[model samples]
Each structure stands twice: as C-alpha cells, then as structure tokens.
Target: MNLKNYPRPFYAINQFCQPQCTELAGRSFYFDMDGGYDYELKVLTGDTCEWNIAGEEPKKAVYECLKGDDTTYMFDFDIVGAEPRQNFFFCIDLEQSLVTLVRCYIGRNPKFPLLVASEYDFGAIRVEGQPLPKKRHCLTGEMMGTTVEWHWNITMFTQHNYYSPAYYRITWPQYSSAEGSISPNFEVLAASDEISQYVKIKDKMYLYCLTEEMMERELGDSSPFRSNNMIFLQNYDRMYHVGRTFGSIMMDGKVVPCRTMFGSFGNPVRLEYNWLTAENPFTV
Candidate 1:
C-alpha cells in the first residue's frame, strides 16, 4: 500500500489480516444523522465515490476503503470541492445496517484554528425496504485499563494502555505480552498522558480516537513526530483495527496535511483495576 507519507514519526501500523476493500464496490448506501444531516454514498467498482448530502452540495471523489472485519467496511474520502478542505470517514456495518461518520477539518476553526478539528455523528443506514437499525455505535468503557501493543512499521512499534476512560498512555516497548504476543524488547518514551475515547460497535468491535495535541504542544516544532489525529475501529474478535488520521504540522515554515488510513493487529493484555486510575476522563 503506497499511501502518501504522513507527518514524520508516525507510520502507525497495518494488520496482517485486513486489506483494501473490494467487497463494498458498487454498493450504495443512505444514512441519516442526528441533526437533520444525511448522505447518499455510492461506491463505484474501483472504490471511487460520488457522495451527496441530502440538502447540501455534492462531490465526486475517489475514496479509500478497507475491509476490517467480516461485515464492517471502513470508508473515507476527501470532500472534493469544499473550501478549507474536509474529509469524511465512515464505518459501515452491513450486519447491523448502522453508519458512523467522522468529518475532519483542516485549519478552519475560529478558535484554536490550527488544530485538525472533527465532528462525529451516528445514525441508521436505510436499505430499500429493510427497517433501520436502532443500535448505533455509542461511547464505551470496556477497553479501560486494557493494554494492547499494536504492530506498525518495524521502527514504529508501540503499545497503548487505556489506563482510564479519558486518558491513555502510549509506550514503545514492542508488545503487550499477552498469550499470543511476544514479550517487550525495547522501550520508547512513555507517551505524555493523552486523551482517548471509545465507542462500542458490536460485541467485540469498537471505534477509538486518539489525538496528540497535548504532546504536540510540549514537543513544539522541534519534534519529528508532531501532529496527530487518529480514529479507528478496533475489531477484537479478529484482533485487528482499521482507521484514519487527519492532522497537520508545521513543516519548514508551512502547514502540511498529514492524513492517512491504516490497519494493524493488537495484542490485548488484561490487567487488574488497581494498576490504573479510577478518575473520570479529562478531569486531571
């Protein structure tokens, strides 16, 4: 997968099982969100997309699709002609007929304008005559305290710990040492405490978001691994995840887009509750 290079220091990973999607090609879908927003997504044979908003402008953009689990298709694309530049990511679950969207923005916000801001929404997928699914993906707590080491490029090995609901820790030790994983071999710096959020999709499936803005602030422009905004679906049943990233960094005195899609496997290790914090998210 010769996807474009991302910001320096973050070639997250790829799962050994997940692959670019071929199954959702030529499939069409309709989804309605909470605030009267909706979309009609048409997936072409080659993964090209021509999507339109219900009451907004339309665009034809080629999309990147990856088959994560058996029924989940992780799809996303740039909004072809929108000013300020935008990207939309969707996790379409066939079995549940559910749809979740994450709309990412460039430097468009009025406040903290340089941050890669995003908005999330979930709704039911409308099939021709089938009733819509009632169970939309919602916030989750199950992953709290669970540690998983995710495989990335050889030099990008890292582990994540959902130490609490609002904060997470990223370490560069190579493995979670779970039953089927290798023991840790090296140590990357303990990531500065960061925020992580999760949403349950199915019995063992979830959507996770991670941002490094806090760390980005500390590292300043001197750091090689700078801006990051990650959102991915974690399929525990298959031990793999597929998701997208869209954030910018100041490179050589210019802001550059560092966005991408990736899939990687994780080894989950269970730990006692006493090992993690008991406080709520973002409470300090």
Candidate 2:
C-alpha cells in the first residue's frame, strides 16, 4: 500500500462487530489520523484506490472508506470471528520509523466509543483484546422528559433473582445441542467502562446511571425469568459479597445521580477498581 494520498484528518477509526458464529468470512479494519500523512486525510475509497489487507501473503482485497459527505465516511465489509473460544488481532504501522504498530481486536460483540483525534493529540489509541458477547439485559430510565434505556450484561441469576455485576462474563449459546450448550467469551468488563453504579437504600440494592434506549423489542419468552426489557438487581443482602457500592452509567456526559428508593436522598460517587490496594492477579 502507498502512503501519500488522501486528505489529512486529525484522526481516523475503523469499527466493526465481532462474529457471533463460525464459518464467517470478512476482514477487520481500522484507520489512522494525525499519527501521520500530510493531507487532511478525509477518507479512503475504491475510487481513490483500493485497500489491501497488509498481512495476507497475496494482498487480498478489503473494503473501501467512502466519503459520505464533507463530515463523514463509511465502509462495508464482513469480519469473521474465530471459532467461538478464540480471538484475532490485526495491526498496522502508524509511524514507520518508530517501529510501533497499532492493533485492533477481532472477536464477538465488542462495544467501543467514538473518538475525536485532536483530543488525543499526542497519545495513541489501541484495543488490548476482544470483548466477549454479552447476554443483553434491559435497564430503563428517564431523561429529558423521555424514557431512556440501555442493557446490562447479565452476570449471575437465580430462581428468585437476577444479577448484573459491575463486571462479568458473556456466553454464546450453541445451536446444535438439544439442551442448548453455552461457552464463555472470557472477556471481563470493568465498572468504569460499563458505566455502571450501585446504590443501597432502605437496605435494598438498586443500580442507577444506566444507558437508555429509544425503543423496545421482544427477544424471547422461553427463559425462567421474563425476557421483557426489564431486569431485577438482586437485593443487597442477597449478594453482599459482590460489593458495598454500586456501579452507574453516565448521562449526557455526567454521572447519573443515585437516589434512595423514595427519591429523597441521592448518593453520587465514581465507582472504580482499586488495583493498588486490591489483589494483584494480572499486570498490564
């Protein structure tokens, strides 16, 4: 691939969903911004020139980034995920002289945020690993006089209650099994990334500051619990081992306030994992 074409936008990004099944065929991609190049780097497209996957020995064809308008661009391509339990990593050199390669993860259902490159002027961005696909659990709230909604990855559940931990596992359901076998994606999430918060009022635990949705849909009705867009945050006493504090998501760029069940008292705090004082299992 040649390097001197395209406008120079401060940043570039490539986003895609990890494959949920096997035998998928596709290419995972990403873009670069101020990291290099002289032009504004508006976008890459088939007309400008085709993109070739750097690693494939024969240089296979990949998707093109078509300029949608003055402010946007789009690309269409299929990304294949490794067999259920595996993952893939693809990389590109941002600064040829520095020998530094920027990488992205290819796996099942990873949620990523959009970024403006200028904000990260000097810092670099990289995806450490692929995120596991979560079993979507619905949580609803109201904002701007309208009902807002989002999902929680169900961590644990029981006959009498359900649990959505601040961080947890996401499992994939097998299609061929008679009883429906499942396998874990093995990706763990943190409270900060999940935008989750917990609260204790009248000794009961309630989660607040969750992502909101604009519409609702029925997924299934066969589970032991209701599959409707609602979830039960198990009482504090039922899962005290989980933690004393709650995890909450941010709204409109601010942390949603936590309140007592009666709405009289509100507790607003940032929930984070203490890596220093807590146990050390993994070193980043």
Candidate 3:
C-alpha cells in the first residue's frame, strides 16, 4: 500500500511480545505534547496501574494522564463509529504536567496504534501551581529529526460532462460593431461514438477527461452548481457544467465541465456535451 495516501504514518511489526512490553500488555497509551507540560494516557484495557503525575480528569471516554515520565505505550480509542474527515485531539494529565495530542482519522475504520516517545529533557516539573505546557508533535513521534516542509500541485483529472440548461442564458461576441448580439440555440441531436477528440476551443488543448468524483471533490461540499447543471449522457442523474473563459475559449481548447454539479450524495454522476455550430457565420 502507498503510505503517502494515508494521513498517519502506519507501520506493522510482528515482534516477540515482552514482559514489561507496554506494546503487548495493552496498557493505555500516553502522549506527551511538550517537555514541561502535563502528560495524558488512555487505558487500552481495564488494567489499573499507578504512576506519579499532575492534575487528572476523565473527559468523555478519554482519561488525562498528568505530567511525569516521557514514555509511549499502545492504546486503542474506540473510534469505529466516528464520522469521516473530522479533526480532534487528545489530552493526557500527569500530576506534574499535562500533554495533548492532535489527531484526525477519516472513514469508519478506527483501530489506531500510537507511537509516543521523546529524548529531550524539559525543566523541573511543577505541582497544581502552573498550567501544563502546550503539546508538540515532536513528543508524538510525528517528526523524523529533519526540517519539515510541504509543496502544492494541481493536476487535471479528466473532463466529465457539459450542459446548457434552459435557465442558463448563452451569448457570443460579434466580429464588428455593425453586427449586434448573437444568441445561438442548442439542442442535442445524437451522440457520436465515444471518440476521444483533441478539441481546441481557444489556445489550450486537453488530452484526457476526468472522472465525475474527482470533479465534485475539487468543488467542495457546498457548491451552487450542484443539482441544476447539465446531465451526463450515459447517466442522466449525473449533472455537469462547462468550465470556460474567454481566454480558454480563444486559445483553441474544449471546455469540459465538472460532473459534480449533480450534487453530493453516494456515487458521482457522468455527462457529455456536443457543440452545435452554424454554416454561414461561425456560431455554436
């Protein structure tokens, strides 16, 4: 499996279980966010163990294991029924300090193993007097001892469908001042064989088409184009809209809209559009 696609770093190791093996014993895993802050631990099972820390509290199935030792243990938070794409965090309470860990897991699969361990030594621990220091990803073992950076890229997945509903008003520019506004009506006569055409609307020319799901994902959850856009040729339920600008059209390229206009739900829809040109003067 590609590790890049997954949100968290996943590693599977089948090693021999040990006696003081916190990994095999199923002890509640504790994550310390900062060097001076309080620590927290969640009991993976109902095994009771006592260790020194700071302030502790039980918050909604999560127990805070306060500040003390910087150690990592195995833990499983019952997150099987959680909603997808939601972000949340966990806090551990140690008597001397407090630690917090931010986490996000999409989809219904929730069995996660946390790897928490740190090498740095913070200042002396305090009692009920001061607030716990803020948690850091370094303690959560997310950092790999290297400078962190990120890059962004946008790629065209495919062209989905096109539609010019009756509600939408289409207009074109006139060549000269003498000619006025021109409005060309369009109606679907027949669809040609799925011939991959290299259409040049203006200057740009596209080689491939995008899948319907990719279109909606780009648009986001609440898109105005959803529902009332053009319908897919093969699947009428799937709606699509044309994405074209004067620059793109004049550059010699085809304007293939996203199929996400059909709305958000289960499966994504598919659609197609064909141009209707005039004989004498160029019109579509």
- Highest TM-score: give the candidate number: 1
The residue-by-residue lDDT of candidate 3 on 102-152, one tens digit each, is 333332222311111112322222334555354321222111111111110
Query: lDDT of all predictions, in order shown?
Result: 0.69, 0.21, 0.23
Judged by whole-model lDDT over C-alpha atoms, candidate 2 comes out at 0.21
lDDT of 2 by residue, 98-117 (tens): 01121212222232121100
Q: Per-residue CA lDDT of candidate 1, range 24-142, in tens?
A: 77788889777478998878767687788886665688888876677887788887776667888888888888888888776654644555666788888998877777778877898
Give the higher-lDDT candidate: 1 or 2: 1
What residue runs in model 1 are displaced by over 4 Å at the alpha carbon? 1-17, 108-111, 174-191, 250-253, 270-283
Off by over 4 Å in 3: 1-12, 16-75, 83-98, 108-127, 134-284
**Preferred candidate (lDDT higher): 1 or 3:** 1
Q: How far does residue 268 in candidate 3 sit from its true spot (Å)?
A: 48
Q: Which candidate, 2 or 3, has the higher TM-score?
A: 3
